[model samples]
Target: MPDSPRLHRAKAGRFVTFQFMPSLNQLLAAHAPLLVLDAASTRIQVGWLAPGSAHWAASFAEAGIGLFECLDQLQTRPEAAGAFVFCDGPGSILGVRTVAMMLRAWLVLRSRPVFAYHSLLLLAHARRDPALTVIADARRDSWHCAAIGAPLRRVPTAELPVRLAMPEGFRTWSTAPADLERIPYSLAELLPATHDADIFRAIDEPDAFLHEEPSYATWSPQIHRAP
Candidate 1:
């Protein structure tokens, strides 16, 4: 596989090196059949997505069993050695960290492009709404909330308004099934389309997010707890 830079500059009439940036089209064309590992929930889900594919193949294991173990087992299959997208999240810290660590290792050893997307981005893509709000349990007393096509933040569950109303005309999507008023979309249906560039742009830039190690987001003490 070619690791050529996206843009090269001529230094003294010689083309110097530059960094490589892959687009969604290139990724799909060069490495069709993308694998997705979503550990953003209590259940660690793994799925396969390809452009224009008619179906999405997926399954999950309990996070308590250890996501790394499940991923290791899944990796034994022939399809595991390829480009992948991982759900970098505000869910189970252990699960997300495990996958993130593995991806960084793969980047150094295999040089495969491992893209990360926020968990809410997946929900937003599934809802297919122009403006949307996604609220997921952040564990403890907070909620992992995001205004899709906008920004993300952690809000306290106690401060939730007395009435859960959509902001203006925006649609509200929540994983809380009891909130029957909120619209819920099938995650499986969106997995295939989730590999596009729009989602990739949400990944934190390498220079800003990665330094001593490859982290998916800006360093937050709350997000990155010392081990």
Candidate 2:
């Protein structure tokens, strides 16, 4: 199949490239016995979708131990998974990175295909509301926003529109807007509704989503000079 369109976002005064995410339906059609991990919120969610199965076997737990607990519940070994799916975040950085680290280690043991989706994008597609804007905290009073048929972007909290939705369990540093909708983040609830939905993209390396690749200036020693 031909690849999807590339997405880009401005980071560090330059736009960074993003791979096109395929829809859940497309993923199901392409791979079987897929293992999915989502740790973008306070609760960690794991899902198992095997060949010819209509429903996903799901589990949820608190962040620190959730991934392992879900795997244990599904009785899945790394080798048993045909391919892996993960939610790369605009949410919990530590939790998302932890899952990414584990996926990297497993890939080293046995090479397999890996795919990823943005947390806000997934929620946006699931909600299927053109007018509703989905957001996650981006710190420093900014928020990551995703609307139907639009690329993800970071907007100032003050600039957010009236129809705003935040997924359950996301942490926020800024005060939430009035009449904000708390959308469900439970995979157990989402998968059944969106199993056939087209909204995932392929990824080679698993890691947390960064609007831009981090850049640092080299430090040099110099004698102090008075202005």
Candidate 3:
């Protein structure tokens, strides 16, 4: 396939043994490096974080690419085997599943740990806004809704709840462009900013990391829940 216009990479760096996974406590306790992958968008993103920062280093983003392609490039990173963080989602089902499955395989084959971040939580963190609402297309005339620091909720478009919805003066972010214009939300792609690598930097609780299989939300009746 022809390379997409958005394909990019920053200056690379040496890999470290420190990683985050299985638990945030282990991450902090081990002071390991972190790898974050966001494959739920039209464009895929790969980034890394140092031991104690929320900033990214040598992060890369590209459109018209698949998860394997992103992993192909990531394989060059010295930290490829480190603990990984993923954006488990309510976005593209295939995209998220492929990435998650590949990472799961890596966990078995390489013994690397895996952690998950809610798609909404990632968007809120990227926006650096504590009060914004996250909206992802849920099909069926409904949408998946999540506020910063809150759990996920499904809401109908026509009957949007005023209180649970984006509050006045608060920004609304989404991964789908159509959702941006159709739902009137802002674009907050999952690519990490230069200053932060690990999205889980500030989290200290061990339970913050996932131990079971990651899951993505869907509206299709035929599709079984992700495991």
Best by lDDT: 2
Q: Report the poorest 10 consecutive residues by lDDT, candidate 1.
A: 163-172
- Per-residue lDDT of model 3, residues 52-166, tens digit only: 4543322124322454455465554524535676666656555567666666666565555456665655555455655556666666666677665666677677655443322
lDDT for model 3, please. 0.48
Whole-model lDDT per candidate: 0.51, 0.78, 0.48
Q: Candidate 3 regions off by >4 Å?
A: 1-31, 52-65, 74-80, 128-131, 161-227
* Predicted structure 1, TM vs. truth: 0.58
User: Lowest lDDT 10-mer window, candidate 2?
Assistant: 8-17
TM-score per candidate, chains pooled? 0.58, 0.83, 0.54
Task: Indicate the residue-level lDDT of 22 in model 2.
Answer: 53
Please identify which of the two predictions, 1 or 2, would achieve the higher TM-score against the true structure.
2
How many collisions per candidate? 0, 8, 11
Q: Which stretches of candidate 2 lie over 4 Å from their true place?
A: 1-20, 52-64, 223-227
Q: Tell me the RMSD of model 2 versus the true structure.
A: 7.7
The alpha-carbon lDDT assigned to residue 131 of candidate 2 equals 97
All candidates: CA RMSD (Å): 10.0, 7.7, 13.1
- Lowest-sum lDDT 10-residue window in model 3: 202-211
- Write model 1 residue lDDT over 8-71, tens digit each, in one string: 3233434322244344445555555556665655456665546665233333554434445554
Angstrom error at residue 84, model 2: 0.3
